[model samples]
Target: MSENNKFKDFFKFGDFGNYFVRVFQKPDPNQKSNYNLRMMHGINKISIVVFLLAIIFWIVKRFI
Candidate 1:
């Protein structure tokens, strides 16, 4: 499928992306906080992995 159609289907799926969009559509402040928390958790996990990879690369470079 084309990129546009693939993106359209992504929002249609009953998953985090759909739920996240629904939360943003609301006017509730609590929903916004929940969304932020979920996003932060995802970022934190990614950051940790990236940091570990960087450390491993540095260690390997030092020995080479």
Candidate 2:
């Protein structure tokens, strides 16, 4: 099999993009509200932010 066909099995970019938007955007109005799910998303957003910040700090510390 070609490399393109092999990579196709890894992930679809559209699904990844949709997940990022779903995590950050307001929940749909028609959907039922769930406090636990909301809190989980909130925690996820915080962790992603922290991870990115740590990466940036590490890069800067390495260069300077």
> Quick one: best lDDT, which candidate?
2
lDDT values, one for every candidate: 0.69, 0.88
Cand. 2 TM to true fold: 0.70
Candidate 1 lDDT, 17-64, residue by residue in tens: 465454444356554456777786677667766887999999999999
> Candidate 2 regions off by >4 Å?
1-12
Scanning candidate 2 in windows of ten residues, the lowest lDDT window is 9-18
- Tens digits of lDDT, candidate 2, 1-64: 8899879866667887688768989888999989999999999999988998999999999999
Clashing pairs in 2: none
